[model samples]
Target: MTSAAAVPTSLLRPAVNTAHAARVSVLAPTNKAHLGNLEHLFRNRGAVESTATAAAAPVQPVRRRRQAPLLRLPSFLKRARGDVAAIATQEEQVYLSPRLFQPVPPDGPSPRGDIAAAWQRLHGADGWRGLLDPLHPDLRREIVRYGEFVDAAYGAFLARPDAAPGDADAVRVPLHDPAYRVTAPLFATSSVGLPSLLALAAPCAAQRTSLVGYVAVCENQDEVRRMGRRDIVIALRGTCTVLEWAENVRAGLVPATEAADAAPSTGDASAPKVECGFWNLYKTAGDGSPSLSEMVVSEVRMLLKKYEGEEVSITVTGHSLGAALAVLIADELAGDGGAPTPVAVFSFGGPRVGNRAFAERVEARGARVLRVVNAHDVVPHLPPRPGGRWYADVGRELRLDSRASPYLRPDADAGCCHDLEAYIHLVDGFLSSHCPFRANAKRSILRLLKNQGANVKQLYISKAVDMRVRLDAVDMPGSPLGRLGTPPSTVLECVH
Candidate 1:
């Protein structure tokens, strides 16, 4: 836990509501279409036209006043309006035309041709120079897969909120790609002083410690051969409790070395600094348990030792708050010279974690970070740099626009914009910034939206489209589970 002496009272106080302001900006239109429409509607509100007299008096020639020069819309607004119109037209067609029920593509492993050869580039070694613009198909698949791992963490926590960490059956959902096996569950305790709503909601919240994520390993030899390395994954879910949300609001910067288990510092002003709240959450421990940092470092070290003398890579993934933690974990893991491996982070809708120097420190350790952001999501722009506190984004960014997807409403709320499921959905259908959402995106839109508690009544999903393809448990070459004949049926409603 952070020492009281280290954090000043001013830093602990809640800052201005910049997050809300950013959210309002995100929801506001970037074009003048709404204003123009209103103007046109009320142009002659109080004036009554005499149609009969005007028709009768048409014989006389009338002098016309020169019209004022029309105001031109900005180029970006023109593009925004064009995209909105295109999406509207597409949705209209889907609603008016006969529904086409096509067989959904099987959810098998997407053919990532020689991922082993280009894994470094995919992992942002060269800052993903050419891979992000067109969005390399392999990278897209990997992003979605890691995103699913994060989703699985959410499912686990929701299913058994009080379940002890490291429970073998903690994760209830089977990943689309059954290449990885859960090794251990990860947990974190809040060090914030604020009163928590979680204490009233669940018994586990009283402890200030809850399961956050899990560590998995690619144990399948086929997957290892295909990837050319044994991959270790650390997947974390976003904030779900009141205490976690409270911790997120503490944006004060503290030296990175303030962490209990952090390395000795050189005692200079140039040392890296991180968000005070995040550091406290990462370093704090429940009653008798180890801090999140200690648990993760210990688990990773053991895994590295077990996979010694083999090509190995570490991928840390999370959504929202989890994304921030993922960056922290990657930095810590990379700083430990004893375990030498390429460390990469795929963060979805994550906020800024630290200052510019902290980012430099992470890069100096050779850790690569790729932040996946929804252009409309406000969370990524959070913990505002008040008085120029030096908060900075730390990696290559892949920005996706929610407007590209025809299935979503144009007026999506802040929650919908920041939802992890929506982020994954956008990633699945994303082709490029210049391209529309892919027509053949195989993920069930209805399923994704429903999981996020979105209104799916307006969403049109054909009966066949609702079904997801799953590899039979026995069909998986090295799956530990016995044969599970068929996947469960998904009943979907098609409301016209």
Candidate 2:
């Protein structure tokens, strides 16, 4: 039997050569870093037109439990049966514009009234707090303490009991390729609250220079558990306590430079981490304002203690909704420290976030939030808005999906995708595009340009390319600051 791993990234392309890979120019690659970088700006701007409803702090009745995370393969495959069957029946994949910043219609015919009701059923998002809200006050407090614990333990771990591999500031980059020098940043993945995602990154966190993160697309705990197991079945081994989205895969090593001994500087903690796995339940566009606001605030607090004086490898990645969340989160982290650090945010179908205001925020933060979309999944395009018609000034939607050919035969693909890993990818690739991580890319790019020069204008990258600022637009000496920034889209401003 042909394993899915046999398929290379290029195999997913179609005969039309319209895949996102083709449109995304290397030099013109849309930067997905700044979307949430300006989250700090938003965080500070409590005065920015607060809505009257702001005072009505809505609450939910559902109970909040400590969500643990993963997926066991046999069961994982069995569970995603319905979704898999759905994908298999489709004949082909579909592609949409990659300009992710465009505004979604606040009021439009929803794909399903039930989904809208789902939003309202949970007290219009209040109920979700019990189900998936990682920002629970207790959780936030735990996260803060956890960050502190991680910081202290990590420092001691690097200090070592008897001997260490290298300097405390410098460590080996774990890699399959011996040729590679620095240790690769590991990814922890879980569909829901699988503990493996937490486990892999958790152990890595023991290293002061390591970065640990997770990606949650499946809002259900069962799904997360299943995903945790399947991930273990894929790359990692043994009994892991947590399953993170990027737990197994590691981005290229963070080159240990001569400044390994230098103390870390305090960048703005106001930037939030990528969106939490719990946000799959967040369906309303109106929630963006407050939800994102809270995320920024929580992340600032978490990071304040976690990264106060550390030289850890900053990694950014997530699946489905998480991937999108990572987009904005990466922006904030990158801007805090110097250098355009590479934090890979591999998203599966994410959704739109906000106007150019958010995109500029992403640009200021250094993030390359790479988004991946499966072609067969219709969820990516769901919560359908009017075609290029919206009430607010939104940015562009990035690529529809990099892998669209599979959607051409949705039935076949969806049928075989019964595993939690497969299901999470399907849900993310189809359903969630407003990944917090991806949402901020454009804003970060624009902010980078704007901060450098007021005359900064947004350069038009290809359609497949995200609408965020391209690195080529920056004025850095060694970098590709060749292109001049363009003003906001006057055309879109004139139109819907």
Candidate 3:
């Protein structure tokens, strides 16, 4: 009997195309009688049989080059079942670092309801002293939730520039992204409070209408409401336009105010010649002129006058551009001595809004400030915080480590890290272990991950490309592989 190894080398290793190899059907022993027919067909069709089947051929594992593990693989695939020896490898594979921020101790008690309720509970009679208490898990979670609302506020306000303060449903035309389906309103005006103040950018011919910021009036419950006490939350939307970027680039340092009696300058001229973007934003109106701060001051005065002789607590909250506005609004409201006293500001991803003198004025107002910063967010590092007091951040800071966030990776594009949704997602993860909502929260997060992936796959790239097509799709400069800043519809994707 001739050995199988004695077959001709050409016949043994047929010239089969790799593309067609996986598609070839297996032949059964019963079909051996038709070998002659099969050979005749192969000859006629210009096809070659691959004796070295893909399954039969030994595939040598490609050596993993010594480099940082770039992609975060699924947890299940990282380790072997019951294999203690793989622990070290698995540990090295994890993309997350230890928690960067510690849990703030609880205050006197946890607040209830939505962001409005939490605001009312935190900022009571004396001042923001209650709010400045190391954030209770309850307050933190609520603030994080409100962060999403603040994000939604931009879309909502932009959708209905003409929306009346009483028209809650009209204001919330309901965009699908970020997905805050807030139905019930604390009052018809403000969703979950008294009324809302929507501030549109100064009219620009380039853009028809733009919403720069808004104030949500969260009243303390009926007991406090009857007493006419209300907590004001001012949320500013971040830059969504090239026009806004132009404002950011106009970084010449200026006095916080035009008044000669303005707050004393910090007197540190050695610092960079950059001014706070927030001050320019505050001074400038939407029409590419100056008036936004004046509008905010007017609205605040109206609210204060409406609730005269009653205790009022105002807390300014915003992300990115809105965050800078939040701090400035707090300073404005507290400075007038007519709006309210002891204001508090919670700023997320806020750029350095003003010079040292500006920050001092905000601080002097007795406003309690908490600047919530996420690790890797490029916004906070802006207006550039170098040695001297050129542009400076004002307030206490709550730093969060987003390295383990599901929406991010160790090497995620830094711009995606600047997203407000990403910040909320990180905050939710921080509260998951300690809060009652953990069980439901985990399910929701998993669903979000799955849905987010599905949504991204529906995009043009995934629909058009096959496995054979390399995913070297262009990544814009200063952007991540999948997340592009332009064309707002782009999805976050990372292809290896």
Candidate 4:
């Protein structure tokens, strides 16, 4: 029942545990019952001999309980039961034997044939039509990839010792995919007088602005060809400072056209209106710096011109408050009539950003938005739409349930539910709404474990410890223990 605000800031950021690497390196076994013992083995290395001896001494037998007699059902009743039993069996297997402890293969799920040929569908050209139901493999990979970009943005922001805006290289975040190079770092300033946790030690002037994110462009020709187009990515991080969190709750709607560069309003009650806080964050500027909108628009225009005559696409991605800014950025780029390529936004756990008119404007601008929402997450339903003030979500939604993944606790806190890592984990394991978490999901569970902290059980760590012990015993040339390869899938089970 603990609120998100009560959660420490360390939980929000990624934790670096030196032992995690050693723990995860040996997590390849398939048995779940030995998990607890494995955890003990790792934590107490001296107990290994005692543990092995204890395992050798186990020889207990249990009495079986009497079973109830089967009911005699009619032929019609048998036919009506058709696949129900089969589905129940499958669900049991999936839930009981999750892939939390399995090692991620060197190469993940096979590439979706040729990504170039299906890039449009993957980019939400047709409103994602059939890609979301079963969750296409290519789209899943792309979602995780973009989610990492947002994580990188967060890393860059937190790495800064001071809040002052720095050079492009200072704020540039290293990405997993080296195909894309960060072109420029983006900074945003707020005119609103709000306190910030980040700049409490610095001057008030330095606290007004900080590095928010960056713009990256695909420079590797091979990657460009594989993707079917040159991709320009604008990845933004969510609210971290106290000032931004305060802005998040300012749900009052204001005219989007109040800014000089904004699209002209029709001067009517139906005019497009955006959240006042989001607008101020986007349009506000420091003493001499350009606003977030200016920096993004200028950088995007430069990239579009630089990559002219080539097949190109603009992808904007973010989480939470960043997601709201992403929607606004997409609206601006698509409506400006300056860029000729398709613009799309991939939003994770984003709250409502505008009213009905603002949504229509975004659609009219031809910007495609796909909102990935965790059903149990409270952020997506935030900035609530009360009776008088209107606030409408503006995107096609792909909903996920946190309860689907056995790796996650059923009673996870709001922070755990809203964590970007959790969103990526859910997307990676997603199959269909009717289906359980995919057993062969390729995303590593280590990240989830690190983020969920006390929320997740020790099953993941225990499995790894068990696998290491088994491998060392068998793989060694002259070991006393005989070879015991991975256990059968039938014995694969999860402990809570």
Candidate 5:
């Protein structure tokens, strides 16, 4: 559980209504689209990914005008927003990052208190109407247009008997399936999935916990990719060849189906499902065994076997720590797991993964991995700037540095153009899931390119500086000197 201290009272402040003003004096359009938009600059051309949704016209960037205050929100939360001033530096230079939101109603008893419960009540299926941004004109239309998939995806899941009400939040199949849970998904995936798995791993900056996730995952893929000579299809009975499937996967052939088929299969009946990540907290082998990233990479090899030489859509998604885990799994697939399937990986609030060289390399190789974050959400800033001692990051590490807020100027370690909500608008643009990608079929295509699979657009993302509280000019929470320390009130923790 998050301790009250760790939770930060400031996070509980009023829904911030402040805006981070734009700093660029000359907002010039790119002649051919260089790495200008924080979203575009973050891309390493080689890391393009392919997606698996119905295609639409290629997205062209459009500028969004700053609008007036959308929702005033509760007063208590407002104080929190005012708190940013306590830490105000000599220059009051607030580092800025691109982030991207809308509105609602009135009525009986203003429901509130605690974000999670608040979301449940106001944004609940029945009361969600109370949360829209009244200032945004196309709000509901946006929801129906770009965001209908989330609802549809839910409906699709409901069609499956395994996707019962208890499974509503299961995330992936492995979390719900018991047959392979005990063995862990590792063993089943190793021989079958490692090839495709490593193919998906890319160079990373891995800032903060994302830094840890990247290091852990990158190292795992490095080992698996080194151990690449084996076949992908070693028979479960131990009689057939050990990983003959590797050759097939190398040639882009999918491996054979696993034993725990939706119907029936010939492989090991108890091999666990492969996808893995942090569920509240990520668990590792106490005896010093495989981590979730390792296990998932292993299962992916096996799972990809079924898709090898076959055309299939593979997408990986995670929120917070889970997003970090997703990166590792995707990386492993791209590098070592058998036969890379078209892949897309989406992570929310992820930290930087690598340096210019590594990011460039990933881009050159054609893989697409996108991240979404709110400007005030500071998890991505943890562990301090990479290359420093791990302890440098305790709160002091996060002190509103360039990496955390993006209010600072761009440097070698500065810029990242990961706005996904924009793309979501073209395909999945509306409905407004708090994570910023502009939802759509394009995002799926972008994911594929990152996985190194050839398919659609290859790569793209949403506009940063989303329509939420623009962290442009405002600094601390409240009062004269302005923007420092934890404010009793908050500004922009509002959610959809």
Candidate 6:
């Protein structure tokens, strides 16, 4: 467990809501349409008719009066408006690279802690919003979008048992059109083959909505096919179900022997270690829950056999308890030595699922593991480190810097940070950039196209400047009364 001192007090404080005063300057029209209005303003003496027809038709000859010259907005103002609009329309995203949090001291025994410290510094004190600008825009977008899909899979899982893929909220995002909906449903158990299971009532209706696993044929295979492989997405919903939380509370840490024994089939000499409870959760589907491991393996085999000769990659995703199971499933698939290896695993707000051995083995398998952690989410720090039991999280952790609030209070029994909604919000915020790209782009173009004079428009004037500076003019007495008339000394005092 990390000490209290490890977490900064500033991080615990409520976020400061800085309200910016927007200056809405209604200037003369810059575009032709608006310029027409300006022309009308000068011609009609600022009393132009509101009706479009009246404006369209020739205006009645107004008494010719001495009219002040028409006021046209400067070229800079036109460019600024165009630049602002272009920036507002452009898509901007933020990406945080794991490489950015490198080991401080470059070589040390506590590099992980150093990395954590570096992350805290960047996240806690940086002037920018918590996340770093995106290192890879496209990749970050894909990850963020997919995290949403995985979250929505819970709604799909909670739908009626007989619900088809295209059924109302059946699958959060559709895999296909209504005609090619996912028909095959995946199921898993509450307890890993534990005897005499307790069948609890479903939350809302007669139909049980707590089925564990989900797998569907890649209805939209464009992304996978692009990589020269067919794909199936398998999603495991988080611990909203009663028994799922019950299993989590059980919190019994056992050796990897039991999990290794329950493997569908063993791998070669070097096999990974995994959490016993999680392994059993996959293995034992009791009366209410279906055996997840068997079902998942069976589905994978069938898909491979059906699509023989084609390359297939399975992407597994989940959150919280479901994340733990997803890790186990990935480890199992990799160990089974199956045809379609688990290509990628995305676990959001996931708890540590296995010992160091398990993590190393999973890393060695060449599977892309992206573990997302919301700021100070309590669930991920779970099951306790009783008696020095070794439980560690797998994959590279992608931390989302969520503001601490009453709902997201770290000490609360029911963690607000653990909620998928919060995770989604943080993830989305991280994946988006509100940086003034249009303004920056225009500045860059102006610098390249025009001389130094044009670059003056790109300067940023601080809005917080104190304009009440003291300016005074005083006559300078000639030294030794030599010069009779001397120009007054202008004093310019600019306040900080």
Using lDDT as the measure, which candidate wins?
A: 4
lDDT of 4 by residue, 1-496 (tens): 1122343333233222335323323342233423422333233221211112212322121222344212221121112211111111332233323223332221233233447766776777778776787676677888888998898788778777244555555564746555689988888666555456535565543366777888999998877877778999999999876567666777777799647234423245497888877888898876677889999999988988888888889999999989999999999999888546788999999999888889999998899999999999999998787773577889799999998776777887798899998998898878667555665464545446444645554465445444443321123222212243333211111111
After superposition, which runs of candidate 6 have C-alpha atoms over 4 Å from their true positions? 1-135, 161-183, 192-209, 221-228, 257-273, 287-290, 340-342, 386-389, 404-415, 431-496
- State the C-alpha lDDT per candidate: 0.65, 0.26, 0.45, 0.66, 0.26, 0.44
Residue-by-residue lDDT tens digits, candidate 5, 432-468: 2221222111222222112111111112211222212
| Comparing 2 and 5 on TM-score, the stronger one | 5
TM-score of each model, in listed order: 0.69, 0.26, 0.53, 0.71, 0.27, 0.51
Q: Model 3, 438: alpha-carbon shift in Å?
A: 7.5
Lowest lDDT block of 10, candidate 5: 391-400
- Candidate 5: lDDT of 164? 24
Clashes of each: 0, 126, 5, 0, 166, 10
Q: Give lDDT tens digits, candidate 1, residues 1-496.
A: 1122343333223322346335433443222322222221122111111123212211121122355212221121111111111112332232211111111122334344456656766677677766776677677878987888898788778776765544535445434446688888888888854445755666555657778888899998988887768999999889987678888887777788745434323244366888777787788887777888988999999999998989889999999999999999999999988756999999999999988899999998989999999999999998776666568889889999887766566776687789887898888777676555554354544344344333222332222123222212223222212232234332221110
> Over the stretch 231-253, how does candidate 2's per-residue lDDT look in tens digits?
10001111122232332221111
Q: For model 4, what is the C-alpha lDDT against the true structure?
A: 0.66
Choose the strongest candidate by TM-score: 4
lDDT of 3 by residue, 193-273 (tens): 111231233333134224565655544364244323454556666776445565566555656564312333446653222
TM-score order, best first, reads 4, 1, 3, 6, 5, 2
1 against 2, candidate with superior TM-score: 1
List, residue by residue over 89-126, the lDDT tens digit for candidate 6.
11111111111111112111211112222222222122
